[model samples]
Target: MGNIPDHDSYIAAAPEAFRPVLNHLRDLLRGALPDAEEMVAYNMPGFRIRGKVVASYAAFSKQIGLYFLAPAISDHAGEIAETGLTASKTGVTFPPHKPVPDHLVKRLANASIKHVDD
Candidate 1:
């Protein structure tokens, strides 16, 4: 993403088709992790708490990926499956047209924060 400095720039640099989805995810994460520090890590916009990254989102050519701690992803596996999205041990990839549900995003963000705090 070319050394983007913040979420705004990262979203601005993303493909037009994915901008709204990225913005929406950013909002969801921000609200869910209000104490988190907003930063660009690994070239992606992410939320960090107590020196640990709790959540992050990125835009790609074909899909948007929402990343969280591996335990958070595993804990919510069933909810993610219900959304019909593909997920790895640490993230979920979904097309912009069918973004992950906002409630689920918030839940995952909180779970991720808890995982790190513990």
Candidate 2:
């Protein structure tokens, strides 16, 4: 796809390719950080609030990764297993070719926000 200037543009430009995942993620993030500001950071889609980086999203070659602002992978170890997330200290990667589970997104979004406060 073409180079999208911002998150909204990026998602809009690749609607057919990114609609389902992007929309789901967007809604979840909004729910988690109701007043967070949307912006493009690090050349990717991101959310922030009162100067804190709340979350970010990226569409890579083979997968999409949603990164939390803090490191809390171990906190949700059990749930992560059920969600089949490939995680790192700051985020979980969902293979692009696969579908993103709704429950997993909710759990992760909650955990991520909690991590921000912790």
Candidate 3:
């Protein structure tokens, strides 16, 4: 598919049931990375800092997925498990039926930022 132009447009195009989930996750990322630039990367809505991908989210049929562009994102397996979300090799998956926990999202965002800048 072609690019969605911007983050808002990308979120707007998601399934109705998924819009809020996407927005919520986006908000969490924004709250954690205020200085990060919003951008469309890999055809998904994402945040970038100093030219490096920081965080990103994608709306899917069964769940909303959040990716912290850090190799060690899975290092927080304990916290991620508490969110009741599935963890993949790349990121965490938040099922649509359950709201993603704000604290977990923030933690992932902070860790990602530190990994990028530290």
Candidate 4:
């Protein structure tokens, strides 16, 4: 992808296998953070609140990543582990066959929104 301007374009430019996953994640984020301003930053789709990015999502060759603040990941460590998804200090990554659950995504998004200023 080269300088994608928005989520629609970013998703369209992604690998065909990942488009649906990206779209699902986008809807989840929008619902979870209705007050957020949608934008593309760092060449990825993200949601911002009060000018601070609270959540973002990206698709790689083999997996999709949903990124939030570090504290949100840490806070949900146990839940993420139970889901058998891979997570770092700032994000969760899962193969297309094993997506992060929708409920979990919403929880993490809400947590990220809450901690936007941290």
Candidate 5:
């Protein structure tokens, strides 16, 4: 409630069923944004680049959620139609049941980096 849970602590504290998923998501974000710093923002595990909030991940009761702080899919609908990432006003969702697609994540990461620099 006061601050988002820390990612490492979250992974360490999560139930066994979610460990692998959390690990994969953590690795994906780290691999994508190798230089981003970890911070807790918006009550989620947030990543930043040059002080810009780029991405976030949350471990929820139903699924693990990832957010790319870039233009929403609604704004880039045509170009990224087949990516299968869903978006709302705030951010996108990558459901935990399926493996997070590498290409989609990379695209989102690029968008984040671009947006942060722009």
Candidate 6:
């Protein structure tokens, strides 16, 4: 708990207050980007490959923010409306009480990866 050794430790070290959502995001990203390297970038848990950042997840005071290097929410307008995500320029936010739907997360992440690859 002193210093987060890596992504897994960062997620593990998150406060009990934010564990569930953080864990869910961790699981989702790991499943989606199985070969991506996990690192702490800008002090957040980040996933990347070939020097391009794909996605990162963090917990705010009362919400979870999943950020992508490319703009992802625009590609997911329908899902955003359907799943109740409060989107930002490069990411979307979900209430800690409401876990983000798995399909939406994968879609956004795949879009982000494609954006980086392109």
Cα-based lDDT for every prediction? 0.92, 0.70, 0.82, 0.93, 0.70, 0.79
For residue 110, what is the lDDT in candidate 5?
65
Which candidate model has the greater lDDT, 1 or 5?
1
Provide the RMSD of all predictions against the true structure, rounded to 1 decimal. 0.8, 2.6, 1.6, 0.7, 2.8, 2.0
Better of 4 and 6 by TM-score: 4
Q: What tens digits encode model 6's per-residue C-alpha lDDT throughout 1-118? A: 3555577677677777788778878889888888788888766888987888899988666677898865666788777878777887788887777877888888888888878766
TM-score of 1: 0.97
Overall local distance difference test of candidate 1: 0.92
- lDDT tens digits, residues 28-73, model 1? 8989999999999989999999999989999988999999999999
TM-score of 2: 0.78
Q: 24, model 2: CA deviation in Å?
A: 1.7
Clashing pairs in 3: none
Q: After superposition, how far is residue 8 of candidate 3 from its true place, in Å?
A: 0.7
- Candidate 1 RMSD to the correct structure: 0.8
Q: Report how far residue 95 has shifted in candidate 3, in Å.
A: 1.8
Clashing pairs in 6: none
Q: Which of the predicted structures, 1 or 4, would earn the higher TM-score when compared with the native? A: 4
Alpha-carbon TM-score of each model against the true structure:
0.97, 0.78, 0.90, 0.97, 0.77, 0.87
Who wins the TM-score comparison? 4
Show the lowest summed lDDT stretch of 10 residues, model 2: 69-78
Query: What's model 6's overall lDDT?
Result: 0.79
Cα deviation at 11, candidate 3, in Å, is: 0.9
